[model samples]
Target: MTERLTYYLLRGLFGLLARLPWVFVHGLCHVFAFLIGRIVGYRRAVIRANLSRSFPEKSLEELRQIERGFYLQFAYNFISTPKLLHQSPERITSEHFIMPDLTPLEEAAKSYDCVLLALGHYGNWELFSTGQLLLSTIGYSMDQVYRPLKNKALDRLFAEQRQRFGARLVAKDKIARHIVEYVRAQDGRHWLVAMITDQAPGIGHATYFTDFLHQPTAVLDGIERLGRKYHLPIFYFDIERRSPIQFVGRYVPLYDPKEGDLPNYTITERYARLMEANIQRDPAAWLWSHKRWKRPLEHYPNAVRSARLQALLDSAKDN
Candidate 1:
């Protein structure tokens, strides 16, 4: 009962927030930044450590600049989500999302029976859900995979928000089976399976280790595995903020592997390289507060890859 009441209270508050003008919404986001940085201090230390390790060549001052920018980035993302909650499909597209050349995405959908896209947490990615006119016109329904938030009430709210514009949200772990069932039900309609997969996998779960953002990082291999399994075409999106409360999406087709044997986790590495390049382009926009190295190389015992990663971590940490 308490959780139910709290959910309604938050839902009401967010609804009110969504009704406000975009300028007002942005101003309110600054207030969020203050709260996040000063009061809540939401994982500021994690942001610091992640940035420091990710860019060891940079000095402390440079790293600090990125840190401050990331807070505001997160602040905007935080409020922009609720801003999207009560918005219409037309309003959401006109105000928030601006996709210039959807040709790549549409073409990818047409070329393959099914399409898979992996995105990093950058800009107002939530906008992608509400603002998918181009995607729908291309005859592609959206199937997004997300990790469920622990709080049941808040999780329900977020799930509702994402589903408002007609996306089918499936839990992360269940995505593989969900996709198979969903496709079978479609009876020939192809769907786009999109997921934000930049988070570090759980201890012993990160199957592909690579050098990303100047550190030996472990990335989940599900995208690659699924792509190969289904013979799906893969793409990456570089979502960027164009102006105050306005953002654009840039789509890049990722590497598709042949049936013959090649580099292991090739698609995963390509996606990471694309993501790393995107982060370098605008350091502030990507998610920094996430503890991306939950189980660094030191955690894996008796593994050949961990030894190499440990050396890289040591070298990077020292500098």
Candidate 2:
């Protein structure tokens, strides 16, 4: 009863926000950003440290600007999510979210049973869910792998919003089972598994460590493992913010097993590099508040480092 009530209350709040004008929504987001970025200084330390280390060459003033931008983008992401809850798909696709090219993704879908797309915590990621229509047009459905929130009511709310379009949600833990069942079902439909790969892996689970954002970063190898096992084509989905409310998506092909054999961790390394370039292009759009480098390499006993990465680390240490 409590869970149901909480869900409806939150749903009502979102519906009210969705009815407001976009201009008003933007103003509201700015206010929230100011409060969190300036007055409350929410996770300021972590954001500052992250920005400073990621761009060591930047002056303090430049770093501060990026820090402010990060907060504003962060606020826009969460606040705009609710505002977009009841938005029309036509308005979303035509005005707010634009997927310019479906050629590459569509081609991949034709040749493979499923395609793997790796994304990061960059831009208004929630907005990307609107791309479900684009995927459907190409005969592939989007299935985003996500970690369920601990709070049941909030989780249900998020699940509902995420799946508001035709996109499907696959829990992170059950992804393997989901994939197997999907294939076994022998449904003619294809799936596009979208996995946001930037979050720092937990200790002991950090199987792959590499150079990212000027730090020894740990990345989850799940996407790579699944892609290799399934022999699916992999692509990096890059989101470019056109305006506060508008964005564009581009699919960059990473690997095709049909082409040739892949080196170990190559897909992950390529994704990390692509993501680093993306962040460099728009430093403030990336999530800076995440403790991306909090866990030390020593903490992960089974972490594997490529020879080239180890050489670079040794050179950095010597210098």
Candidate 3:
């Protein structure tokens, strides 16, 4: 019915846009970014505030530059997503997407039943699904854990797009039993459980406060807990956008759960540090508009780990 029709109409529109010349598509993105970035004034302000708080050392002019660049990147990401929907495997791989050194992950996966892949909002995350498909072609079963869109129609469309390459899409809400079963069932075959680690966990969830840039940020402990409980290998996927059409992936190993007394926080810290490093390298690529610190420390004080963070916030008010 209505939902189905809406989905089809959106898909048709995207398909039409995808057929346009690359320059035209990119130009449309630039225009869209300019318009939306202005229209969403409150969101832009919030992003600026967060950016300023995080990078206190950066000048206002520098912050503004980063803000504008982020909007441009956001616009391009939206435009490219539609093109990705209609793109073939050969087209994606041939277009400067390079994965460097997956040997460690491949070797670790053979022994561990599951692998928890820590990724972030940086780069074109949509391509991560395609990359997983490429890995599957070489014999790995990649299951992507995703938070479903609020709109059911959009959710269905996103699921369809992700599954086009044969990778399994598991909703984050329905992931526990499915992940355990998949790991046990697929022994020799590599299993990748990819989750974006940069998002703030919901209120009451266990989180560690870390110094990201200059701000005290709460990092999710879910990945570490899961890896420890399931004895899964942990790896971080570092994505670098080399050009308008190219990306590079670097894999970093975290810890072995089988070893006596694994440092869970250490592993999570390493991943978070890697994400911060990547964001510093390309400030525009990370999602800047997310209300990452929505839940205040007053409401969830236990989540805050660094006393220095509280001191910084206190000092900011005085200044």
Candidate 4:
């Protein structure tokens, strides 16, 4: 009963917030950022620790600026996400997420059977999920593999927002089978599969590790594995906030199995490098509060398969 009331309250708040102009909402988000970072100090330690470990060269003062900037963008993403559902397609594309150079992705769609997008938790990722609407008009269909949140109401809310632009949201466990069936069913129609791969792999998920942001990171190998099996080319996005309310993104396609000979985990390593570069560029748009390196390498079940990664993680820890 209490949880139900809380859900209703949140839903009502979203409705009210969604009605406000973007500028008004932006101001409110600044306040939200200040409260969370300065007064509330919500996960400040985690954010600091993440920033410090990731960029060991940054001085204390430099890290603080990044932290503040991160908090501001973080609040903007949080506050704006709920309200985004009410925005028109024009507002979404024009003012919110402005992706101008989709030509490369379009070409990939034309050439590939299925294009797998390796994504991360960066700058208005929820908003970018709506890109399917734009791509679909050009004959490309989009689907994403996502692990639902614990709260059912919130999960439903996210699913509705992300699926608004016609992107299919498949459960993580069922994603592989779903993609296989999708590729088989679509025939000539191209399926663009988006998988946010940077988050710490949950139980029974990690299969590869790499040096990401100067720490031993366990990366999900599913995207690369599926790409190799299905002959799909992998792509990643470079998302940067143009302003408090706006973002610009470009797709960085990693490998073309048909064009080149690349080994396994090449897609995975490429994504890690691309994401790290983006983080280095902005240093704040990426989610720093996430415990990205929580799971140690030794805990992984397939140590022999991942021995190289394990050694890297151990070496990072030693120095």
Candidate 5:
């Protein structure tokens, strides 16, 4: 009962806050960023280090600018969540979201039972999911794989918000079987299994170190492996923020299941390249505060190829 009341109170507060002017909301974010960035010195330092590592060619001033922009964007993303939660589909679509070419993904979905839709924390990821929901309403069933949040209350609220557009949220732990089942059940109708490929996988998961933003970074291999195992088509969804209120969705074909066997790393590398390109185009739009490189130095070093990644690759080669 207490939890329910708290949830409703939070929702009410968000709805009320959403009524504020856009400029006011953004101004609040700027102030929040300034304070939070100062208090969280370690996070700011991490972002700076990451920016430096990713863009060594960039001048110190340029990197600092990127870091500052990242904090501001991060703050805005947080502040705008409530507004997004309360926004209706009509309003969201009418606002600033445009899908230039969704046909390729649709066509591939028709042929393949399951599709591995790779996206990143670029632009408004929430908007991308909403867009996916809208696409599904036209005739597609999207099963989104999401990492579980530690806070149960927040997680429930997030789940509700994500499902507002009809996309099913499949928790990460249950994703493999849920995806297989969903694909088999859908049988040819068209089902998209969306996975954010940019997150760093937990320790001991199958990961590969690739050249991302000019740095050796470890990335998850689940999407590619699952795509191969299920013979699913792979598509990369690039979210471009045209304005604070609008975004453009661009689809790029990554792999066709019918094509010959492609290495998982190859597919992941291709997706990574696309994400890098997007981040390069608009550095601040991507999620920069995430501890993307969280693995310990002894585990996954900043060197060209970390020992773990090297061993994994070597083992694969031997096999």
Candidate 6:
């Protein structure tokens, strides 16, 4: 009963907040940033550690600046995310979230039945859902893959907000099945699958270790495998925050098996490099509080690794 009441209270609070003007919400983000980053010091150690390790070449002062900026960006993403639930399609598709020249993606969709999107937890990633409505204008179906949250009520809330714009949410494990069904149905509609590829791979998931952000990082290889098997065209977004309430994005074609064959881990390596460049452009824009390197490379026995990555793993394991 208490948990249910808490969920309702949060739902109501978010609904009220969502109706507020962007300026007011922007102001609230400052307070939220201060409370979490300054007063409560929420995951300050983790954030600082992540920043320092990823940019070892930087001085203490530089890392500190990045750390502070990360907190503000994190706060903005969290507080403004719920606004998607109440905002109209016009409001969601406005200048606040710009997608400049989607010509490349559109042309690719014309040639293929499915396009895979590789996304990182950078910028206001939640706003990417606006693509369901925005891309639909061009006759494309959008689907996002998500791992279910532990809390049932919170998970339900997230589902409602995510699907509010017309995108279907598929369970991580069932995404392949969904894609297979979509393709076999021969509906003659273009489908876009968006996957957040930067997270540390979960247990039982295939992983590949590579030098990313100056460390041996583990990345999910599912995108590469699926794209190769199904000959799907893949793309990644280059997003830049224009203001506290706005972001401008460009879709860049990453890879397509239909073009030609590439070496093993080539697709994942390209994605890692692209994501690394994105984080370096605005260090604070990425999610620093996440324990990205928590799972040491040595944990996965079957993980694919290059010589340098393996050496790093061996050295860490010996220490």
What TM-score would every model get versus the actual structure?
Answer: 0.89, 0.95, 0.91, 0.90, 0.87, 0.92
Stretches > 4 Å off in candidate 5:
1-6, 38-42, 186-188, 296-319
Instruction: Find the number of clashing residue pairs for candidate 4.
Output: 0
| Candidate 4 per-residue lDDT over residues 90-158, each given as its tens digit | 888888888888887778867675788887888878887778767877788888888888987778777
Clashing pairs in 2: none
Residue 244 miss distance in model 2 (angstroms): 2.3
List runs of model 1 lying over 4 Å from the truth: 182-186, 257-261, 301-319
Residue pair clashes in candidate 1: none
Residue 11 error, candidate 6, Å:
1.1
Best by TM-score: 2
- Residue range 1-319, candidate 2, lDDT tens digits: 9988998999888887888898988999999999999999999999999999899999999999999898999988888887774667788887778888989987876777788899999888888788897788878888999999987889998888889888889889888887776666656788888999999887567888887877778888788888888777889988888776788889999889886777788888988899999999989999999888999776876788866568768998899
Better of 2 and 4 by lDDT: 2
Q: In candidate 3, where is summed lDDT lowest over 10 consecutive residues?
A: 301-310
Supply candidate 2's per-residue lDDT for 130: 83
Task: Tell me the spans in candidate 3 whose CA falls farther than 4 Å from its real position.
Answer: 39-42, 304-319
How does candidate 1 score on lDDT?
0.76
lDDT of 3 by residue, 192-237 (tens): 7888889887867746776776777788877787888777778888
Which tens-of-lDDT digit does each residue in 84-126 have in candidate 5?
6567777777675677677887677557666778999887777
Q: Tens-digit lDDT track for model 6 on 55-79?
A: 9999999998988788888888878
lDDT of 2: 0.85
Span of ten consecutive residues with least summed lDDT in model 1: 301-310
Order the numbered candidates by TM-score, best leading. 2, 6, 3, 4, 1, 5
